[model samples]
Target: MDIRKATIHDIAEKLKITASTVSRALNDNPRISDATKKKVQKVAKQLNYQPNHIASALRSGKSRLIGVVVPTANRNFFSSVIRGIEEIANSLDYKVIISQSYDDYDKEVQTVEALLNARVDGIIASVGKTTENVDHFKKILRKGIPLVLFDRVTNELDVSQVVIDDYYGGFQATEHLINEGCRRIVHFSNSQNINIYKERKRGYEDALIKHGIPVDPNLIVFSKLQLEDGRESMQQILDSKIPFDAVFSSSDYSIMGAMQVLKEKGFKLPEDVKLVGFGDEPFTSFTEPTLTSVNQKSIPMGNFTAETFFEILNHKDQSNNIPRKTILKPELIIRDSSINKEKPKDQTNLEVIEK
Candidate 1:
C-alpha cells in the first residue's frame, strides 16, 4: 500500500513520449503540437501531476509570484484591495503572497525584506503610517525588482504608484459639511507626516477658505486617529470649550469613536454635530445613523497596482525610465450623518471628483 506523487516523467512514461516533449507540451510551448499538448495535459490530469513551480522558476528566473504588503487586513479597505489584487494576479498565472505591517515601520521593512528573500517577481505595497525613511524600498529598486505602491504612498521613492486623489476627497467631504451650514467644522487628523493625511488636511483648509470661512487653527486636532484618539480629541474639544458644529475625520474608525462620544453625551447627530468620515468603511452604513464618507476606490486601486507591476515587469529593459503615477478619483457618499434637515442638498446623489 505505497502512495507516490506524480511527476512529468510519470506522464511521459505512461504516454510513451519523451519527458522533454511532455514538459514542453505541459507548458504549452510553441514547439509542441496541439495533439501532443492535449494528450500530455489529459495524461497529466489523470495522474494528478502538479508542475514544480520552484524548479521552473529556477530554470526561467521567474517565480511568477507577486508579494503584497498592507497596513492591516482587519480593515475592510485593505482586505478589499487585496481581493482585487489577487483577481488580476490569478488571471495572469501569478501567485500572490500578502503581508501586514500593522502600521509599524520596522515591521514593514522586515516584511519587504522577507519577500525579497523569497525571490518574488514583484511587489505591491502600501507604506505604514510611521514609515518615513524609504531606504529599504530603495533596496528593492536596486535589485531591479518591480515595485508599485498603492494607497499610502510617498514621493520620496521614484517608483510607479496607484493612489486616490486624497486632496479632492477631503475637499469634497469638507465642502459638503459646509454646504450643510456648518461654519466651525472641526477636523480629526491622524498624522501630518503621511502624504495622504497632509493632502487631506490641505484640502480641508482650502475648502474652508474657498467658502469665505477663516481657517481656525484651534479647530484642528492631531492624533493617531484611532478609536481612543477620537474619543480623547472629542473630550479635549469639549474641555477647551471651542465652538464647533461639524467634524471631518480622516478615518472611519476615528469618526466612529467620536460618534460614540457624541451619542453618550446626548448630542444629536446632524442637528448638533454634523460629521463626515474618510475611507467609507462598511460599518458606516450600518451604524446607528448612516455615516457620510468618502469612498477611496480601494478595489480599483489594488487592481491598478497589480496591473502596473505587470506593465513594469513586461518593460523591465526600460524600468529605469520615468515612473508612472496613477491618480484615481474618489466619490463622496452622503448619508444621515452629515445632512442637516434644514439645509439638505441632494443626499441621494453620489458625487465624484477627480484631481
Candidate 2:
C-alpha cells in the first residue's frame, strides 16, 4: 500500500471539519478556539503535515524575513552584532539572512541585489570600506523596502543608523597615551573616506592640540588598517628614524601587527613605547602585555539597529514618521600596553621627548 502526504484537507476530513477551519487553526488565528487549535495541531503532528511557508508568505504578502549585510562576518564586532540582530528578530518570529561584502564595493552591490531579489521584509547593513556609491541602497528604498545601517554608515542616505562615538574613543585613547608619558605618538589610520576613521583621526589631532603637542604629518599613516598595513606602517616609522614613544591604531588587527614588530625589535610594551588600538578584540586581553583598546559596544549597536528596522517597518505606512539616527558611546579599556607600571604622582608634568 502506498502512503499519501498529509495536508490541511486530509486533517479536516479526518476531523469532519472544513479545510479552512483546519488552516486557520494551524495558523493559530485568534478566531479559532484554543481547543480547536490544539486538536488541529495534534492531528498535524500525527499525520506529519508540513505547512508551506513560501506559499503562505506569497498569500500574506509578508515573507517575515530580514537581510543583513556586513563588511566581514569573521570579525568579532560584526559577529556580535549579528547575534544581537538574531536575538531580536527571532523574538518577533522573523528569520534573518546574512551576507558578507568582504569590504568590496562590487560584492556589496551584488549582495544587496540578491537580498532584494529574496523579497525580504527589511534590510540591515554596515557599508563596506570601499562602498562610495550608495545607489544600490537607494534602489531598496525605491522598492519600498525598509533599510537600516549600523557602524560604517553614510550621511548622504537619509536612513536610520546606529553608531558609536568614534571621535571620543580616539581622543580618550590618545590622551591615555599622553598621560602615560608617550610623546611623538604615531597614528595608524584607515581610509579617510570612511566616516568612522575620519572622526577618529580628528579626535587624535584634537587631543594632541589640546595638550599643546605639535601634530606631525610624518607620524600619521593611512592604509586599509589591516594587520599587514600595521606592520608596514611601523616599519616606515622605524626607517624614517622618527623618534616615537607611542602608537594608536584605528584597528586592533593593525595594532597587533605593530606590536609584533615592536616585540621583534626588543621594545618593552608600555615601557619603551606605549600602544592602544580600537575594536577591543578578544585577543587584546590575551597577549603577553595585554593591549589597551576601545570598546565600540558592538552587541548593543546591533540590537539598536534591529530595533530601528522594526520601528521603520511599523511606521512604513506613515509618511510623517521620520527615521532617526542612534549614536552609542565608546569606552576606553586600559591595559598593560598603555599603563605605567610605576604610577606617577602627577603624570601631567611628565616631560615628553620629540624628534
Candidate 2 lDDT tens digits, 152-206? 9999888888888888889988988887777799999988989999999999999
List residue ranges in candidate 2 displaced over 4 A. 1-22, 30-54, 316-318, 344-355
Q: Provide the TM-score for each candidate, comma-separated.
A: 0.87, 0.88
lDDT of 1 at 36: 91
Off by over 4 Å in 1: 1-22, 25-52, 343-355
Clashes of 2: 0
As a whole number from 0 to 100, the lDDT of residue 182 in candidate 1 is: 91
Output the TM-score of candidate 1.
0.87
lDDT by candidate, in order shown: 0.88, 0.88
- lDDT (Cα, 0-100) at 197 in candidate 1: 93
